[model samples]
Target: MALSEQGRHALRHPPRWHWLLLLLILPIVAVSLLFEGWTTHEVDGARTRRACTSPIPRSADNGAPVLRVTGAGAETVQMPLRTAALTFDGGPDPVWTPRILDLLRARHAHATFFLYGTQAARHPDLVRRIHDEGHEIGSYTYTGGDLGSASAVRSQLELSLTQTALAGAASVNTRLLRLPHTTTADTMCGGEWSAARRASDDGYLLVAATARSRKPPLGVVRQYSHSALGYQEATKLLDDPEVGRFTTVTSGLGRPSLTAPASLLQRLQGNALIWTQSLGHRFARSMTWALGIAGGLGILRLVLLACLARVHVRRQRRHRSGAPWLREVNDPVTVLVPAHNEEAGVEATLRSLLASTHRDLQIIVIDDGSTDRTAEIARGVGDPRVTVVQQPNSGKPGALGTGLSYARCDIIVMIDADTVFEPDALHRLIQPLADPTIGAVSGNTKVGNRSRLLGRWQHLEYVLGFNLDRRMFEVLECMPTVPGAIGAFRRDALTAIGGISDDTLAEDTDLTMALWRVGRRVVYEERAVAWTEVPSTFSQLWRQRYRWCYGTLQSMWKHRHAVFEVGPAGRFGRRGLTYLALFQIVLPLFAPVVDVFALYGVCFGDTGQAVGVWLAFLAVQLVTAAYALRLDHERLRDLWALPLQLFVYRQLLYLVVIQSVVTALLGTRLKWHRMHRSGTANQHLLREPAPQPSGLASK
Candidate 1:
């Protein structure tokens, strides 16, 4: 099958896996949320407080019972005078570990190195090098999470995974372990004591740091990190004469040690842990990169929208000021209204067209197999200029093609069945056709049924998102879609593109792109305004947007070859298609992940940073939306719905894009979705008189 056919098939019968993929994401998010919440409650909060203020409890003689657990679960161990043990915790760092190792090598000192499984797995060579260099290896746990606060499973996994990494890296496992966040043997208290006892039961020896003093203490196991600062601190101890001998904990204790070879099963488990940890690390890195890309693209789009909107405003002002120099096209025109089960708004649409300021018009309403009285309503208008044509069901594109066939004028204006036009809308819509280079013109479309929150949210989107985007597209000379709600095209342009194609669901977009490919300019005429009723509920809105998004994908794919063409087609293909793919399709797909990351930050990471970034992005949107509303002569109060819209309405739109892309990829075909209209378009227009064009004469 051809690529287009494949796309159609994907839309019609989307593979089950497509939905499964989306469903899978939900469980992942839920798991992440649960994990993050648990971590925050059990570890993160306490950890933060401990970092700010010492968490280790003090005991008499500066020996904390809860800080350390030896083989016998002893709070403190008595060592021979003039002997000191050096221990390093928290890493097998690629950079710092090597430097520390070099320092230790220069001093000919061997210390116990407590390795985090995650870091050890990531830098297994370092782990092996530490062991090979005659240093004692011990477990610092998998993620260096505090075993004191960890669940039983987490504590076991932490220690076992570290052992697994050790066994995989060096084919040997050690009994020595270290409790994370504990400073000295005397510092272990409450939960730390309990955790130490548990490790002792598992046949692991626990090591902790001795208290720091002006004079180095002999026979004390001093812990340090594998970092530059730790190396500096350890240098002081190595240089101290009081610390007579620097050796491993077991050596200092006069215990003979032997490297035990790992069992095959142990090695296998270790390697598996290493693989899983590595995969998690890679996934985290990928998400970080994705977040950056998504954020950058989103910001770039906003900046472009704002800048291009200013350019559009300036250009429009220049045109308005020099209106006398503008050529007025007063040629006879044909208006096509393709209706399908649109009995609710067809009469109002016909009445609005009859009220156009331009005198000459041939209005044709093509009823495409409507089960309602849409045709009857159009014919009942009883106007000479209005003609109703009945046709069998063939979809919007086919009905539009039929209307185009009966068009008698050089210019054809197309409006949706649910749209109500202003008195001067038709006149302003056609004025752009006076330019021979301009093949088609897109008009300003506004949401009519905006009383409810959903409608109000969509209203803001129309003025802020769609209309502002059209202005930018016009300034760039890469207008991708002349909206079906209100657009005008030269009849020659329509004929050149073979009337209207039913190949793609979005006929208007497809035709607009075709016009651009043929080297004809498509411009936006903001003065030509039409009010159209939007979906009233979430479900209805979702279906409408799904069809729109899918249709747009089909159109873009159909014009894929234009990217390699010369001149205008290449420009439109590269600039227009690239913009659409990035800002529309790609960003929306990644937005859910961004939201998930933000939620994670709030739960387990830095809540302030996450909220700050989100607020900054929202601020940029608010400014842009405000400017867009200003340009469209809409009230700023509508922006109150925008923030709330971001939470729910925005997500719904993203889901629509996701579903559409999935459908397109799976080669499922989708039937056209028709909204159930309530004639809200007429109600809105009747609520207030339509604004007339300034300094323009009505025919």
Candidate 2:
């Protein structure tokens, strides 16, 4: 059925909201990365912190911790009374800050707290408590980073963001600034003094701790953290008989409070910032869990494939070891070639089949309304065994059905018009069918046009991702796909399912599952090699994969009831279908999130860990791919581009799976999309004698 104009337009240019949603994903991910970075102290952290580099100037009275700077000069400020100003540095910590506040409450002390923006943002209630208890607020330079070591922009952001965090948490902004990793006014040397001067220009009164020796008798300004040691020090000082009343810096200096109530607009902006940070935190946390699960599942699948492949190989060796397991099948067979505008490769396909080592053959070419000379090219092969059937513009299943009507032989082999089979491929593909219980045999499908990087990637995927999994599937007796490029079926079993039906875009998958439903064993034949052309460009690959994925989903849903049925159907349903659902459908959905989090880890989090995991994952894949390649008798050099494939090729496949899932869920009908054949499937054959038909078998 033809889609409506709206549907066509919608498919071509999806609704604005769809694009808007896509656009939102990046910004949302970026914000989430930023939030996680800030929470983890990556934005302004101890890793980038430094200590005071030079001594205090002589013009500034050195012993005093607080510096009072005017437009003309700078001087130290001290309490007129025999008073000590108690200031806490670093946290508004969740546990320590609360405990310290309790001690201050008990003593009726109003001190100063220089807050880390991260801690304040994380524990806003503590920030509010400090302000409400009459304790003065001061900036602790965001993540307690040293201002002298940081760039000018870093210094400003640290100060402003801290002010905003305070405004959001307590509705107040402070003018008192304390550079982290710097202590005692005398220690403010070189770059530290310059940074202090810069803060003074912004109306910030720079505060440091007084020298420990002089401060004990002179009632010095003390610096502490919201920590156990800081609490113990504070308690002892509170009980000191020599020290006068414990109070805030401003109060002891006989000056007004440095903190002022934030403007309404400032408060709103600050609150928004706070809310965004919290939301990002939640998003990051969720993605982290999702990424871990996805990563684990991915690794688990590779391990399963590797282990099961070994079992599959051993089983094969055992089978052939005794007496050629299922005796060599020399039965007459009918080969069905479905084509639509496949002129470029129809001749090569027909020639390859005609030259089959299994001599007795009947080849039927069903040309479904080709604008090009596909039937002509096929007929040009000039073999009595070849028969070309032309039909109106119908899909692949239709073409297959038309060809099936002409299949006089009991064994039916279907090969796409774009595939070139090795001489022994057909003979080997059918040997498994000799076992009466086996209904279908999946041949090894290799990418032939692998001279280019894109082709190499596809070749790797064919050997590693698809073929390796098939080995495992065969071992588990749950094989899901028999490639359209080369698959064999018993005529009785093929006919039992009412021949081919256009039930799904992936007729091969649908047909294979149908065979399994009727208690037919589908097995893989790695020795049965056929070379087919995979899409060479990203767009071409996308269309081909999109159709395949969508059709697979439809077939899975169609055969969903098989899960409850007993025997072969139940095994395939439970194992093959479940695996497809979990690994293919569900896991790929989380890929974008996983990919973003991976980038976050590399850029803003632990880069070594991130890169190490990625390299490890790639290394495992490479090892498995090498094993698979050796099993298929291919060279190992193809793995040189495997790393690049992970970064580029994998993302494209992820997107394809995502879009296909979305299209399936939307109930969109995916019309059969035929790829343009470039006759590249016979690339290996070209390396053979020009007169003889051969594929990779010649090599």
Candidate 3:
């Protein structure tokens, strides 16, 4: 089962996550079918338009009863107004519209076609044909389509009339108009009614579609153009003279007409159909809940995994005192630092690396199109060990690739310009390269400063969530990410994977997975730690984490099939894939919901249900927090923010997942949302912002 080059290329590329989201897709499609089936049933048996507009002939003696409402002083009273004709609103699509017009043409019909301005204009020949066919042409208003302000509404209607005139409407002065979507009965359109009054002054009459259809005394014929195609057959049946009931408008030139409602099963089926009309809404809601619950489960699983990882790491640390995992070695390492708009941070990063005890390293700072003095500041560091390369802003992947091309050393260490490495971090990171079996080593990243509450929370997160759990993956040789901040890879190992693809947002993660796919082992060095700055503001944090989470998803989605291959290497690959899917993919999606849903429960007065679930979720979070603390030696106080993080921090991850999922689905533009640098180059990273004077809102 070996892959050819072409097959490998195809296999190496990750299918869109939507393919996996097919997990939810089947259920969604099923739900849609149920609703659609119900709609088809109701439309087949439901009432059709009972009335329409035709010339009454001003002098003709008509028997139509015109019930009137009049206001009086002593006997003043309010009464319901009756309507004779039903109106169809919004549309002029060619597909079903022509059929409707043809049906009307066959019957020598004259129902007002309330046409959308754009549609009417686009299909003017059809509008001209509608007029040519002797139908009463009406306006659904231009952007009756747009539910906006009074002025906006007027503008929409006026545009519609103008377009209708342009479309060869027999007369733009036609008084008939139907509001978009909602009826005059809905509250949102009361303002529309005022707009309607202004329209009335122009001789306009507001119309509503009252699903009633019947034959008149003089062989009067009418037809409707429904928004959907499925409704066409049903409307035809409803208007059938043989099996259907006849309906008449009270104001029309006819005796008062009353039609019976359809059968009991039809009513039941009708209610279901109406609800089914909102199938998209229902599916969206269901998916939202599924996403929430899935997120909660993902987080919970991450917690357990992190705890287990920490326990394993401690055991390894105690037993392997020979320091075998940290065996120091000398191999000339070329450190690639991709810089973009990093004038504020690049110098410090170079300064930190130059200060490292690892003397055999050559630092290449690739400035990826910085408008700022990023390149100048990088060279300004004045270290012979540092080399500054300039290029257009081709992005990190391109920058890293450029740096790698120039690299001469056997090992390549990719570091972010924003990160500040400790003196020994570089030395310890490459130590694992001494073992021929180890092709790559990933370093732990610590928050440089955590004075702000947000920073502290992120600090806690790195310790508990990533570093602690990465320990287990390291031992399993299934490590999913060799972070861009500090990852050491054998130059040959990297080149063997055909270098990194700039197309992905998370190139580091992509490279790591690629290495594993080629039977190269990646290990994490807990002792090799770099301190990096994180976003301080809520918006900044959201954007940063969103990119990271989404990018990781993209990478995972890209390399999904590698998990659990059969040959020793393939088996290892499969294990890695399973670990990521379970820990990274499923866990993050599920954990937040455990927190959010529990909160929702409390709001609904389900105290018992809320408390039970809340405690269980909190316990998982605490386990993760405790484990992160053990790895990074941060305080337990930071763990208390976990619940609050759910409300504020984790929701952003969901948004990112949703955004990424949509992008994958629709093939949206994928560009890296760069993280902004905060402090002066000479200054250390800022502490997280202080808790609000009033903490409740921040909480």
Candidate 4:
């Protein structure tokens, strides 16, 4: 079976030209149709009309002046009409429809009301009244079918037309159409050219909603402070007479010119890649675009994030540099430790609590009827400062609640039995509670033994994620959670919020919000660090994080009423709630898709050189990790793991998020699953187990 060296060489080293040939021919082959001279004029499935070489000039009558403007890569014009048309959609309801008709009639206007088929069928008298009043009655749609798909758009359009024709003989020749919800382009209007051609072919002219379109529920349109600048620009454009020419609302009236470039961009163009690509085209383009845009956006984003990280580091440094917070709290504190099946670590945790530099701390251990000798070990700690309470297992929240009820101090600190606190952790944790305005303080949690790759990753997460970001949230007075692992609270603050509820999975987040509602200040103390066991196996990590995410969502749902409150925090509460939704929920859901598109750009888009895109994206991830590492003092080599982590590992988060969301929607329960720990920080510590001395052995 031995082959000659020459034969082996021939098999191993093939010609490089084969690779070069593919690289040269792909782009030209892919975009050949776009280069074809054929100009698509109309769409068949959806009613659409492309801006095809400007419509033929129509005669102006009834003392109407022709208005026109062209500048800055755009053109606008207005035509006159003998009659004004107003369209009202989405009701025959008592709340809105009748009032809308009175308003239109007051303006001496004739409107074309597009009724929902179901609502119209139910309100036959209302439909007749619209026709009876000389207003042109129409249909919104039969079932709110999207006007993006050819068949769906055609069917919906015809159904609406049929319903309108039934209302009156004059309505049979109606050509005006509107899309439901307006955010239909990416999903239904895949190819603009094709959709336009289809709609025009069906003798329909698409009408776009203007800024004056129906406001969202509760007049919240005015409350959209996040995009206020953009809205203000849009609002100003709505008032301009020439801007009305490009707008459907003033198509027949002479109006002011449109100003905002962004408004124009959104109205005129659709994302060709997102909407019109075949699966093959998508696969080829996804990498190129994903790597390019994500690379660019991710770079600027990381730069800003790095600055924030710096701010966090500086704050932590200042806190550590100045007098420690714990020096102020001289009163004896009640430290509550909730233990369940924790015989392995409960003793060590108790020992650490007894060793606290603050001599005024008393430890309260609640042993929730563990199957093991957890209660006996806790009692055997023999510290006069410790009080052991035994109760049947009712979960961690229930156990914590029971201990809290019996706590004798104004300041109460909750620490997990598995967590070994730093000598100063308890002192530093309670320092913030001394401030009359402060309600709670959260301690930083670090990984006890980060030897495995998974553990190291978790370590990185704690340093950069849990520790750093939380400081920023605290500065904004919107700290999302005071972690159960090592958190201290003012007893009055807890009592004001009616104590922690065990209904939701994440009692910590729920409690945090309750504190905020009462206007209690929560602070993060970096010096108050505890080393605790983290999930070592991938599956354990998945389950732990899934519960965390699900619990977060559950708590959010349970406390949604606090979002717009004029409570103690007021504006801070509103902003904090907005940040929670934007970053935690929305960004996690969208970031994966954004990454996919960046990859598409790297593989197929016009990102100059392919290697350039690759390098840019690599630089962003590296820069982000570098700053993140610097802020937390993690190893620099951790940055190198980002690409691999993103490719092979980060996607697991998306799956967990999806699963958690689905489970929540379906009303599923998930109890916290603890991971196994080696019970030692180093391999040498594991050489011999801790000696079972006689004083700690008896129940």
Flag regions of model 3 displaced more than 4 Å.
Answer: 1-303, 318-320, 567-569, 582-600, 603-605, 680-699
Give the candidates in order of lDDT, highest first: 2, 1, 3, 4
Report the poorest 10 consecutive residues by lDDT, candidate 1: 45-54
Give the per-residue lDDT digits (tens) of candidate 2, residues 239-345: 88877688999998889999999999878877876787777787778887887878888888888998888888888877876766558899999999999999888
lDDT of 4 by residue, 1-699 (tens): 111111111122223443355345445433422211110111122334223333222221111212121121112222332222334555566555665556546545455555555455445466666666666543455444444443644654445433443233222223444444442222213343244335445544444332334232211011111123433443443343432122123334433211111223322221221122233344434544544554555465456556655676666556547764435776778999988888878888888788778888778899887888889998898888899999997877888899998888998998888888767778777877767888999987877666667766776667656775676676667787888788999999999988867756677887888788888888887667676877767888886887678778877776676777875456446766766675566555555555545444444344466557567667766766666555444457755556666665667776566566655554544555555544654232244332221111011
Location of the lowest summed lDDT over 10 successive residues in candidate 3: 69-78
Please report the candidate that would top TM-score against the real structure.
2
- On lDDT, the leading prediction is 2
Worst 10 residues of 4 by lDDT: 217-226
- TM-scores, all candidates, are 0.88, 0.92, 0.57, 0.56
lDDT at 67, model 2: 87
Q: What do the candidate models score in CA lDDT, each in turn? A: 0.79, 0.82, 0.60, 0.57
RMSD (Cα, Å) for all candidates, in order, is 4.3, 3.6, 14.8, 20.7
Quote the RMSD, in angstroms, for model 4: 20.7
lDDT of 4: 0.57
